[model samples]
Target: MTFSDVVEAVKSLSTDEKIEIQLLLQQYLREERREEIYQNFRAAQAELENGSLKFSSNIDELRKLIQE
Candidate 1:
């Protein structure tokens, strides 16, 4: 089904059901975000181990690195 179809179905739900669905969606989004963060952390760790990542002690150094 399309997004519009899903929207119409949600609109037909009772108030309580809508609230439950909202909570479930929030939980699912949070879990997705957490997993994304974990994956990013693992990638950064691997880059560091391979000597391909640089560490900066200040904003100036970070800016310089980004410019390159």
Candidate 2:
């Protein structure tokens, strides 16, 4: 079904069902965010292993690194 159709169907749900859907959406968003973080961590690990990752303790150096 289309997004608008799904939205219209949700509008017909009872108040309790709407609340349940809100909770489910929250859980799904959290799981998605967690997976995104894990993927980024894996990419960073690969960069570190390949000697392509750079680290800095100075603000000016960080800005220069980002510009590159």
Candidate 3:
């Protein structure tokens, strides 16, 4: 169906049903994004643990990189 038809169908739902659907969608997406962020953080932590991560101790170089 087209976007307008989907919207019209949603508009026909009761207020409580619409709210519940919206909450469910929000919760589902939030959980998905949270999982993604957690996975990325875990990968970075592993890199640090394996001595594959690098850091610059020079303040000037850090500042230049941040600006870029």
Candidate 4:
């Protein structure tokens, strides 16, 4: 439930159990991060397809043009 409870429970497990739990947690975290990255990529792709993305060729040139 809480971090302290998790730690206490882990402390009671055998070495093999601890290792198995650690691996399972690591895999779960990896999958979560991968899904987050994929969602970001999909959103960017949609923005590009819908013409909602913009870019400037030259920062200095753009600034000069804007100042005029």
Question: What's the TM-score of every candidate structure?
Answer: 0.90, 0.95, 0.64, 0.73
Q: Write model 2 residue lDDT over 2-68, tens digit each, in one string.
A: 9999999999999999999999999999999999999999999999999999999999999999999
lDDT of candidate 3 over 1-68, digit per residue (tens): 99899899989999999999899999999999999999999998998999975579999988876776
How many residue pairs clash in all the candidates, one count each? 0, 0, 0, 0
Candidate 4: where are CA atoms >4 Å away?
56-68
Supply the TM-score for candidate 1: 0.90
RMSD of each: 1.2, 0.7, 3.0, 5.1
lDDT agreement of model 1 with the native: 0.98
Cand. 4 Cα-lDDT:
0.91
Worst 10 residues of 4 by lDDT: 59-68
RMSD of 4: 5.1
lDDT by residue (1-68, candidate 1, tens digit) is: 99999999999999999999999999999999999999999999999999989988999999999998
> Which scores higher on TM-score, 1 or 2?
2
Model 1 misplacement above 4 A: none
Question: Clashes in model 2: which pairs?
Answer: none
TM-score of 2: 0.95
User: Which candidate number would show the highest lDDT if scored against the true structure?
Assistant: 2
